[model samples]
Structure formats: C-alpha cells, structure tokens
Target: MYRYNDFDEAFVRERVAQFSGQVARRIDGSLTEEEFRPLRLMNGLYLQLHAYMLRVAIPYGTLSSRQMDQLAHIAETYDRGYGHFTTRQNIQYNWPKLPDVPAILSDLADVQMHAIQTSGNTIRNVTADHFAGASADEVADPRPIAELIRQWSTDHPEFQFLPRKFKIAVSGAEADRAVVRAHDIGLVLRERAGTLGAEIIVGGGLGRTPMVGKTLKDFVPLQDLLPYLEATVSVWNLLGRRDNKYKARIKITVHEHGIEEIRARVEERFAQVKPAFGGIDMEMLSEIEAHFAPPAFVTKPVDAYTRAHEADPVFRAWADTNLAAHKAEGYAIVTVSLKKPGQTPGDASADQMRALAQIARDFAHDELRISHEQNVILPHVHKSDLPAIHAALKAADLATANIGLVSDIIACPGMDYCALATARSIPVAQGIATRFNELKLEHEIGPLKIKISGCINACGHHHVGHIGILGLDRAGVENYQITLGGDGTETTVIGERTGPGFAYDEIVPAIERLIAAYLELRTGPEETFLQTYRRLGMDPFKTALYPEKDAKAGKEKAHAA
Candidate 1:
C-alpha cells in the first residue's frame, strides 16, 4: 500500500477543514441545498434516497490491516453498522449524517485514505487487478503504475472537472480481473523488446452506451506512459461532448469520432506535452514501486493443508472456489465472498470488516485487497493457514465459497436506496440467488457471472456480465432488459441486447429459463453459459424463455382467447 507523505497529509487535512467549514455553512443556512450540491459531491458525499452516502476511495483496492480497521471504526462510529463495497472497489456508507462527513473524512485521513475523486466528473480512483502483486501470471505489479496515475490525477488542476466521470483500470495478469476493457482508460502491462510497456485501451465504458475500449496504442514504453495518459485525458477534456451528460463520456466520443481521429488528436497532444515530463515522473514511479515491495514468505510445507482438504468437504469446496493462483509457493489469493444468500451484495458489516482485518494481520501478511466484483482478497495467505482462515471467515458468514459461480452476483443499490433508480435491483439479485440455491442449480450451472444495474449508468457492470440484467422503467412499471454473450475478461465483449424487456415479476424465471436452456444446449460441462451462448445464438434461449409464445399462432390465439 502507498503511504501518505507530509504533503499528502497536509492536502487531505486542508480538504477536510474546507469540507468542515462547508458543512457548518450549510447547517447555519448560509448555503442552500442548491448551493452546496457540487461542494458535497466533490468531497464524495451524496444525498441518496434516505440519507447521505459517503464513498471512500480504496486506491487500487489495496489496504493495510490498520487502514481496514479505520474503515471499520468509521462504519461503527459515523454511519450504519455496515458498508457497501462497490464495483469500482470503493466502499460506500449509505447512512452517514451530513454533519459527520468531515469527521469521517478525518478518520480516513488518519489512515492515509480519503474520499477524494471517488465521485464527481474528475478522474476517479485508479483501479487495478486485486491480485496484482500476488498473482502468479502477472508480468509486473500494476500497483506502481496505478499509484503513479493516482498521484498525477488527484486534485489535478487541469482535470478537476470533466464532462463526466472518468475511470482507469490496469491489469498485469493474463486474466483481466480488473475489467479494464470497461473503463474510460485501460492499461494492460506487457513486455516488449525485453522492456516493460503498456497496451493502452481507451474510451471503453459501461453506461447506456456500453463499449469495449479500442486499442489506442499497441505498446507505450514505460517512460512515455504518464505523458500519453495526460495527452489522452487532455484530448477528451478539450474535445469530448459537453452539451449532454449522456454523450459526454469518452466512450461516446470515441464512438462518434473514429478511433483513428481520436488517436491522431491524442498523438498531437502527446507530441506537444511529452517534452514537459523530463523523466521526473519515472523517478516518482520508482519511489512508489519501492513502497510496494513484496513481503517475506516462509517456505512452509502444505501437507497439513492437503490433509485438511481431504478431511473436510466444505473446506475443500471453499478452497477450490475461492482460492486464486498466487505468485509465491504455498501462498494463495483468497477471495472473501460478500454474496451470501438474502444479504445485500457487496455489503460488509463493521464487525466483519474488523474480523477481516484481523485475518489479514494474522494470516495474510497484513495485506488486504478489494476486488472489483465487490469482494475482499487476502492476497498472500499461506496454504497451511487455509483451514483456520476458512473457519474464521465461515464464522463471519464471509466464506460462501462462491467466487465465479451464479451466486456470486454483482448488484447496485437500486430503488431501495438509490434515488436515481427507477426500478429495484438488489431484491431481484437476492431472488435469483435464493431461487438458484433452492434449486441446487448453482454448481450444476458452472461458472457464470450475472451482473445487475439499477439503471443505465451501469454501476453494477451489467453490460459486461455473461448474463446482464438492467432494471428500467416502462410507463411507471418496473421492467428489465436482458443481454447475453457479454464477458469481463481478457477477451472483453459487451453484451448484446435481446429484444424487448421483461416484467419485473418475470425476470427470475426468465433467468432460470436462460440457464436451463444453456444446460440443455451445452456441448459439455466445461462449457460456460457465455461460451454456450456464443456458440449458439439467442434463439435457443428465447424459445425456453417464451415457450408458449414459441408455439404455433393458432395455439397462441387459443391461449389468448
């Protein structure tokens, strides 16, 4: 994790003091809701359905146990007893009092954390693969680059305000766990000519106009990355649509103007500004890299772990599903699933947060990571500690053992919480998870990703889901639009929309029908729902979804009559 220096500390403290004064002015009637709106938003505070929600940035989703403890303390003291982890790997407290926000920010600053750039139309938190440092397949740790970007973008005078929110994600591993393709800017670390570089993918996003990013540059050398990134954002900042909020995202800009034109503009900007970098950014990156050095690992035998796995089926199942490939021998990246049946997806209670912090301190080399799917990861847990860690997590209800399964859903706070939402998403997610669990079909369904967004903003990443569900409003009635064949992986693809939307009541059964169709049509058990849907088209699933409609016209007429 990147520690805050004196400058960083002073900057945050000053921001906190500024917000504190703003809060006082609002309370004392000097600032009206209209006047105070942007100020609050800039500080990562939002007035949601029932209360004020405070979103705190977990930069690149990396945190120390002490930082986790601070978050837990904030949750306990300032807001509700629990916090919601979002798809961007940030955490949101849905019930913070307006007056206490500055205090909350102060607590976060105490731990070298803040809510800056977690919201608003500025460069949002720069995310990366949760398993960046620990993943065995990684070419390099993406955190150093992520941190560099973070420093460059934080309160960046040039980019303080953009047409819309900007997001950047970096991935060093072969698997795109960071969902880079769905971001405004995506960087894939690669090696070329025996030197490290990045494949820059730009203008990808997942709002109403979802798009997989186009490759702007095949290989940008390490030295040129910051300049290139600055150029890219500068181009978008100057030329991106400002007339309409919906059209303002770089995704639409890229869609409207061809990638070649955008590339040309970025190149021109880069050529002009590249000289200003003067290699200082590289030295800063190297300093950041020094902070992220890997922790020492013990050469421990895993015979005990093998014996435990052989003895306990439940532990074995958990190990198989939740453990990811680790870079160190006998070490595993453990994903703690937040998706327990009937619970709000991506929510962790204060106690659960504290417990996870304890686990990180005791067993995970004091390193904790938050995955983009809204789960926590203990990035360097020894295999021998698996049994104990599993037991503790199971006690906290964090060990659901559903990593990529159907039950591991990503959902947004819909009508139940989000004022912008027209339809509910959380309940629908719970319904699907509960129905699947009741049917005992989750395991049989195999690896499947189902993402639900409350609205077209695509906060839950519905566009990249293998099965995407978007909640919508149709003449004041709740409805859902389904999209299939989407994937959030290295081979990223935005889901294609199926015809018309379904009624809210009919969505769960519709999803069940889709899964059942996949089961029936799949060539083998190894084929995932997305794979099957890609091989075969929507027609097969459409038939299953509307069996009565698929019948003859006469039969349909008879039934209707």
Candidate 2:
C-alpha cells in the first residue's frame, strides 16, 4: 500500500534502463550468456528449460486495485495469458521474450512494483503475514517493518552478492501464518511493557539443509531492529561458506558453527553497528506505519451472509472453507483458492486477475493480498458481501471450497519449467489433487497440507507439509519421496522421510494409503492428521506407506503369537 516516492521512482527507472541495455547487448551477441547470467539474475530473469522466466516481487504480498490491473495487463501483453503465483508470495511469468523484459519492468514501475532482488544472492522480498493488518489475533501489523527492511536491503552494497540468497519473513500474529521459522531471518512482532519489539530468529532455511531458526534475540527493540538484522546477515555474509554452493545458506553455517558462537559473534557485531543507526530506522518505521493503517470500515449487517449460508449448502461450504476471522466487526478475510481440482496450482489467467481486482475494488476496499499458500486474499470484505463475492468467484471458476483440505496443495514449477529441477512437480500435485477429489475424502481429511517440490531445493516448501512429496530422478526414473508430520506454523519442524521413495505412478496410491491409515488410526475426525501423527508417531504412517513391510511384519507377528 506504500506508493513510490520520487526517489523510489527514479531508482526503479534507472534499474530498468540499465537492464534494458544489458539485455540488448546480450541479444546482439556482444555479451555471451555466461557474461550476462549474473546481470540477468539480478533483474529476476532466468533461462528456464524452455524459455525465460520473470519473477516479480509483491512486497509484503499487498496489492492495490491499480497494481492488480497492471499485473493483468502484463499477463495479457507480455508473456502467456497467465502467471504462476509462487509459495514465496510472488508471481512468475514462464514465457517471455528477451527483448520485452524491460517493457515488463516499466509496466511494473508504473504501478510502483519491481523485480529487483526477487532473485540473486541478495536479500529477497521481505514477506509478511497476508492478514497482517486485518487478522483478529495480531498484536500489530508487521508489514511496516517488512517494508522498512525492503527499503534498507534493496541494492545494499555490502549484501548484493552474499554466499547465497537470503530470505526474511515477518509474522504479525500469534498463529505464525508466515512460516517465520523457515526463513533466513524471521521476525515475530510482540509487545511488552507497552513497548513494541520483535522476537528475532536467524539461520533457518529449507533447501538441502533444513533447519528451524534459533532465537537470536528474545526481543530487539523496534528502534534497534535494522541494526541487529544488519549485523546478523553481515556475519553470515562473511562466515557463510563460499566454496560450496550446496552449503552456502545461513542454516548450514549455523549448523557448522553452534548457535551460541554465532550469537556471540553477532552480538559483538551488533555492538559496533548499533551506534551508527542512531534511531533513524525507528523514525522511518513510524512514517511507514501510517501507510498501513486499517481501511475505513462501514457498519453492515450480516443478514445476507446468514441467509445464504442457511439456504444454500454450496455457499455454506465455501464460506466455511474460504473465510478467516477479521479484527474489524462485520468483516471477514476471504481466501480465493487457486488450487482447483485437475488444474495446475497457482496459475491465474488474465481474466481471473481482472475479476479479483474488481472483487477487491467493489466489495473489499480496493485491497488484495497474495498468500504464501499461493492463494488470493480479500482481507477486509464485509460479511454481508460474502454471497456476492462467492458468486463472482464461482462464475470465474475460482470458487473451490478447499482451503486447508487435502486438495489445497502447494507445488512448484518443477522440471516442467525450472532447469534446476530433477523431476516434475506440477503433474504430481495435479495427480494427487485429482485422485483425492475423485475419492471425495478431502473435506473429511480436514486441514491436511501436501507440499511437493521438484528437488531438494524446496521451491514448493515440501519439507514443511503435513504430507510432503519430493520428486527426484532416480537412475533415469522419476521417484517420489514422502515425508510425514512436517509443519510450517508456530510449531515448525522438518518432516521425517518414510522408508523408501515411490515411482511416479505409485505416489498417488501411496498417499491414499497413508490417508486411509490416518482415518482409521485417529480417535476422532477432530484430531487432525498432524495431531494423530504426533500422538501415534511415525510407525503407523510408515507402515501404511510400505504395505509389503507391514504384511511381512504382520505374518511374523502371527507366527510368533
């Protein structure tokens, strides 16, 4: 919601001009691909398997109606007619011409958006809770802090080329919707003694070495936040491994050097850095906070929503799945599902974008949010507008009553698009969603998260799913590995892998068997898969995954008995 000031506008314009020149040189063969790789990457351009992919950052995942219109325009004009929303709360264009990327950036600049730092080994987009300003449970909105960090880190000379890409996420609520623990720097907003501060976490990451971040500081006063973060990442930028790409993430560095040592070093560095800040960061934050003030609320009766829920079972089901509690009276946060059955997860067409923009403008206060789950959010919709919003979504094929159900899967553009991927992720996710839809058991399963990644690089965040599926090319065959009991919430943990990987064709049935086991093993439906898994541990799910082993054990037990 923060509009670009004149300086911000000039900065983006210069970046676009520079990148346009670089791209033109590359096209003319004056600069080879090898020479242009880093430059292109810094601008969020990647050469995928088939074409160039452009990732545009949605800072803090907040969007205005005008920005949404610009995005739709980009989808229709530049690349394909659709864009893929990523788990990082960004959007990607899989097919774009080399010459047109500059134009794309210009269009984004028109709406106060950009692709800078969306890629490269620099500080990426600073993400925050999608419901930051509206969540009923929030202590304070964290996007102002996220936006502050974004301003500080963009093209920061010291961190432009670190050991690896660094990510930061902020969680404003008690529920941890932003997966703060899985980030390089995770900040949890809290207040004590009438003073606002953050619980600072460091060295958490997924990819090859999965780690839940350790508490770097129990509380960093809001004034001292940027200084503390600078010291932390600066330490990692120096101490992190540059020799091995696989071990370059801060998580690996934290693993190699104990958290205590890292903490001591960071503290020493913070001591030096703290004085230089002199509270300017806090001054900036006060200004940023004003931009995120809650929209003006209009009192409205919920009679229409109650009537629709009572009269129409379909509307009731959708309302139940798609809505979240809002801080304001007579308001609800509506999640528009992108994971419709048999469709690629998170692919939104130009028409869908425009429709969502219209919904945000007419019903929700001209505001929209992109969620880390790859869904669209209308954060301040009146309860009375629920039926109309649902109807519009239904007409656009966006109304899928499956937000936290098994069918609401998070998947990456695996081998289908990413050259780094070893196997395809989209097909596997689609197969699982289609299978579960046919079984009609997803709603019964209740709040199951299935995340699929193409490789160990975890673009889909597979390590944090309740049921995680990792696709790999094993000896020339596509193999799928399953991990159970993973969570990406306030209680974050990396999932445990089941015994062996399954073939591409066998993965769907394997998931089905695991769900069936949970259905039978649970004490009641109220106990979700995660709770039952925690209660019963891995034996049940592991046995279900490997039926042959289960049968062999069963036969041996019978003989012994």
RMSD values for the candidates in order, in angstroms, are 1.7, 1.2
Q: What is the alpha-carbon lDDT for the whole of candidate 1?
A: 0.92
lDDT measured at residue 269 in model 2 versus the true structure, 0 to 100: 97
lDDT of each: 0.92, 0.93
Kindly list the per-residue Cα lDDT of model 2 for residues 1-561, writing each as its tens digit. Answer: 787889999999999999999999999999999999999999999999999999999999999989988999999999889999998899999999999999999999999999999899999999999998999999999999999999999999999999999999999899999999999999999998999999999888888888999998999888888999999999999999999999999988888998999999999999999999888888888888888888899997899999999999999999998899999999999999999999999999999999999999999999999999999999999999999999999989999999999889999999999999999899988998999999999878898999999999998999999999999989999999999999999999999998789999899999999999999999998999999999999997888889898899899999999
Tens-digit lDDT track of model 1 for 1-561: 788889999999999999999999999999999999999989899999999999999999999999999998999998779999998889999999888888899889889999988888999999999998999999999999999999999999999889999999999988899999889999999999899999999989888788899999999999999999999999999988999998999999999888999999999999999999999999999899999999998998998799999999999989999998888888999999999877899999999999999999999989899999989999998999999999999888788988999989999999899989988999999999999989987878889999999898889899999999999999999999998888999999988887788898899999998898899999989998988988888889878877776787558789899
Work out candidate 2's RMSD over C-alphas: 1.2
Candidate 2 has which clashing residue pairs, if any?
A: none
TM-score of 2: 0.98
Estimated TM-score per prediction?
0.98, 0.98
Report the backbone clash tally of model 2.
0
